[model samples]
Target: MKLLCLSNGHGEDVIAVQIIKALYQQTDQIEVVALPIVGEGIAYQKSRIPIIAPVKKMPSGGFVYMEARELWRDLQGGLVGLTLAQLKAVQRWGKQGGMILAVGDIVPLLFAWLSQTNYVFVGTAKSEYYLQDEVGWLPQTSFLQRKLGSVYLPWERCLMKNRRCLGVFPRDSLTTHQLQQFGVRAHDFGNPMMDGLFPEVPIVEEREEARSLRILLLPGSRSPEAERNWELILEAVESIIAREKKRRLCFLSAIAPSLDLNPFCERLQAQGWQQNTTNSLSTPVQDKQGLEFQKGVTRLLLTQTAYHSCLLSADLAVAMAGTATEQFVGLGKPVITFPGEGPQYTPAFAEAQTRLLGASVILVKKPSQAATVLHELFSDPDRLQLIADNGKRRMGEAGASSQIAEYLVNQI
Candidate 1:
C-alpha cells in the first residue's frame, strides 16, 4: 500500500510527521511519502520522510490568507506556477493508486481531493473553539459568523462529507462534533500537536526558601520573523524586570534549533544585557546549549536544546508563536501573547488564537502591557487555575498520534 501525506506550514508539517512516524510503528506494509506545500518542509526532512513532490518556499510562507498584501507578494513570487506543479505531482502519484493524509487546511485537503484518491483529513487549521469555547460563544461577532456558526465553514464540511474523503480528524472534540452534525465523518482522537511534548529532563520544584518565578519566551520558529519577535519580547522582558525589580525572575527563551543565537544575542547586547557565564542566576537546567544573559537581577537563558524543559518548567509564558504556544498551553501553562507584523503572527492571527485557546491565552495590545498582565495573573490564583484547567480541556491530552496511525493501518 502507498500513502502520500500532504501538509502546509511549519506547524502542520510537525503534526503530519508525528502521525506518519507513529504510522511507521503500526505497520511496515505501507510505503509513505510526503508533499509539503509551504516553506521547506523541514519537519518532513527531519523525520526522514521522502518528498514525493517538488516544494517551493513562497514569499508568504504559506500564510497568504493573513493579508491581501501577502497574497499579492506570493503571486509575484510564482505561487500559481508552483502550486500547479505540485498538483500535477499529486495527480501523477495518485494515478498509481494510494491513500492521502491531508494535514493543515484546505490547500492540502483540496490537493488530496483533486488527486481523485481516497484520503483522510487531519484538520489542523480551523477548530470549533475559534467560534466558541467549551462554555459559550465569544463576544463581538461578525454577521457572517452569526449565520454560519461553524468554524469549518460550509464548503469545508462538503469536502469532508464527500465519499473520497474517508475520515476527518479535527483538532478538538467540539470541531469533531460540529462536523458530525453536518454529516461529516469527523473523529475526536485528540490533537497530535499535543503528542510528544515531554520535557527533556524532569523539572524539579524549587525549595520554598529559594523559590523564584520562572517565565518562558517563545518567539516563534520561523526566521527573521522570530528575530523581530525576539526584539519585541525583549521589550516585554525589560518591562517585566522594571516592574518586578525586587523579585527574583528567571526567563527562559526557548530558541528554535534552526535559529542562529548570535543575532538574538546581539539584540540583547545592544540593550545592555551581558552574558552570565557563571550561570549563578539561573535555576538548575539540563540544556548544555543554554546561554545565560543578565541585566541586573533579571536572568534570561536563551536555550536551543531545552525547549521542552522550558515549557514544562515555566510558571507562565510570553509567546508570539503558533504550535509552540499551543503546546505550552497544552501543559496547562498560561500564555501571554501580543501581535507582530507578519505573514504569520499578525494581529488578526493573535486575536484568532485567543479565541481558539480561549482563556488559556491572555492577549494584550502591546508588549509592555505584559508586565501588568503577569502581575495581575500572579495575584489571582483562582484565575490562574481556571486558565490552566481551560488549557487542558481545550488542547486535550496527548497520545493521539498512535491512535490515528492505528486507525489508518486498519482502514488501509
Candidate 2:
C-alpha cells in the first residue's frame, strides 16, 4: 500500500513516525509518502520512504494570514500548494500501485477528501471536540481559533462524515464516537504514537552507586513560561539541596530551536548551579529500554531525548503542567505539576491535570506551595515511594504505540 502521512507540528511528527513504523511492521510491501507542514517535516525521514513537504517554500509567519490564504486557495483550486504536495507525492507512489493513507493535519485531510482518497487522521487536527475541550498553552483569541472556528468546524464535520475517514484519540475512546456523531465511520485504536521513545536502564553511575537521591526539574519546552517555572523550581531545588545534602539535582533542559536558553543557563550558573553530567539510570529490570545521556554543553537536547533521559535517571520530577506530566505518568514516575499564573494553566486545567494522572500527579497552586511540597516529599522518602508505586499501577504497561498502529491499520 502507499501511505501518505501528514503532520503539522513536532508532536504530530512523532505520532506520524510511529504510525508509519507500525504499518510497515505489519506489511513491509507498503510504500509510505510523508507530507508535513513546512517547518515540521524532519521526523518522517527515518521511515525510509519518499517524503514531500508542501509548506517547504512558504515563509513562516502569521497563522491568520497564512491559513486564510491557504484556505481561500483550497476553495478555488480544489487543493492548496501544501495539499498539492501530498497529491503529487501520493500520485508518484501510486504509480508503483499502492493506496494512500493519512495520519495527521487537517489540510491534507481536505486534499484527501477532494481526491476521494482513503485516509486515517491521527492526533488532534480533525477532532472538533478536542478543540472545544483540550487545554493548551495558547489562548483562543491569540491563535485566531475563535475566528476560524466557523470555517474549521464545517470543513471538519464534512470530512468526518466521509466513509474513508479514520481518527486517533490520545486520552479516550472518543475518536470513533465523536466522528460517528457527524455521520462518519470511526474506530478507537490505542495510541501507538506514544511508543516513540523509551529510555534504557543505565549502568550505575558513581553518584547513584552511593545511593544518593536524584531529582529532576522540568519547566517546559518553551522559554516564555519555562524561565519563570525554572526560577521557581530552582528555588525549591536549592531548598532541597540545603536540607538533604545527599541528593543531586538535574534540570531537564528544553531547547526549542526558535528560543535560546543561554542567558537562563548563565543566570543559573551565577547561582552556583551546573548542568548534570551523570547519565540516565533506569533499574536492572528496565535496562533494555532505558535511554542514556551524552555529556555536552553545545548541542541543544531534543525535548524527547532530554525528557526520557531525565525521567529514567531521577527518583522524582517537579515539572510545569503539560505533556511532560503525561510522559512521566506513562513512565511510572510521579511528577509534581505546577501551572503558573497564565491562560494555559487555568483553574480548570489544574483540576484536569490532577484527575488525569490520578494521584501520580500533584498540582501546586502557587510557587510557595511548590517549595513546601518539594520539601515534604524530599523529607519523607516513604511518601515519595508510595506515589511512584501508585503511578506504576495507574499507567499500566507501555504498549500504546503498537495498539495505536493496529487501530489505524484496521481503519482502512
Candidate 3:
C-alpha cells in the first residue's frame, strides 16, 4: 500500500514527520510520500521523507488569514499558481489507489477530498475551546456558532462528514466530542504536538551560584521577526536587571537552525551587552555549547544545541513563537509574551494562545510591562506553580505519534 501525507505550515510538518516515523516502524510494505503546502518543509526533509509537492516560504509565514497585508504579499509571491500546482499533484497521486493523511487545516483536507482518495484528517489547527462561551472574550467566531461543528466555519464539518474520510483526529477531546455531535467520526487519541519531547537532567557542575532566576527566550524561527523579538526580549531583560540589582538573572536563548547568530550578536552589542571571551572552547561552559554574553549582573547564553534541555532548565520563558511556546508550556513551564507588529505574533495571536493554554502564558502590552510581570510572577512562587500545572493540563501528554500511526495502519 502507498500513503501520501499532506501537511501545511511548520507545526503541521513537525506533526507529519512524527506520524511518518511511526508509520515507517509499523510496516515496510507501505510507501510514503509527503506534500508540504507551506514553507520549505525543512523538518520533513531532515527526517528523509520523500517530498513530492511544490513548497515555498510565503511572506505571511503561512498565516495569510491573520492580516490582509500578508495575504496580498503572498498573492504577489505566486500563491495562486503554487497552490494550483500542489492541488494537481495531489490529484495525480490520489489515482494510485491508496491512502491520504491530511495533517493540517481545511486546505490539505480539501485537497485530499477533491482528489477522491481514502484519507484520514488530522485537524491540527482549530479547536472548540477558542469559541467556547468561557473563552468568548478571546477573539473568536460568533457566539451563535454551531457547538457541534468546527470553530471557524461549516466547510470543515462538511469535509469531516464526507464518506471518503476514513478517520478524523482532533487535537483534543473537547473538539473530538464536538465533531462527534455533528455526526462526524472524530476521535482524540492524544496530541501529537506533545510527542518526541524527552526531558534532560541539567548538569549540576555547570550551575552558577550567583544565578537566581533562569529564563528561556524563544524568538521564533522566521527571520527579521526573530531578530526583532530578540531585541525586545533583551530590552525587557535589561529593564528587569536595572530594577533588581541584588539578584543575578541568567538568560538562555534557543536559536533555531534556520537563523543566523551574527545578527543576534550585533543586536546584543547594540544593547550594550559584552560577549564573555574568557571561556575557551575546551571549557565546561563552552563544551555545553553556547555563546555567552553579560550585561551588568545578567548573563545570556545563546545556544543551538539541546534546545529542549534549555527549556527544562528554565524557571520561566519569554517566548514570541507559535509551536515552540506550546511545547514549552506542555513541559509545565509558565511563559510571558509581548505582542509584535507581525504577520504571526500579533496581539490577536497572543490572546488566542493565552486562552488555549489557560493562563499558563501571560501576554504583556510592552517590554516594560513584561519586565513588571516577570518580577511579580517570580516573587509569587504559588502563582507560578498554578500556571505550570495549568500548562500541563492544557497541552496534554506525549506518545500520541505512535498511537496515531497505529490507527492509520489499522484503518487503512
Best by lDDT: 1
Candidate 2 segments exceeding 4 Å error: 46-50, 56-115, 124-158, 166-170, 173-188, 200-210, 223-229, 242-261, 274-306, 340-358, 375-397, 403-412
lDDT string, candidate 2, 156-179, tens digits = 767756675655343334334545
Write out the backbone clash pairs for model 1: none
lDDT of 1 by residue, 81-137 (tens): 988989999999999998999998988989999999999999888887877766676
TM-score of every candidate: 0.95, 0.64, 0.91
Preferred candidate (TM-score higher): 1 or 3: 1
Highest TM-score, which number? 1
* Ten contiguous residues minimizing lDDT sum, candidate 1: 279-288
Candidate 3 or 1, higher lDDT: 1
Candidate 1 TM-score to native: 0.95
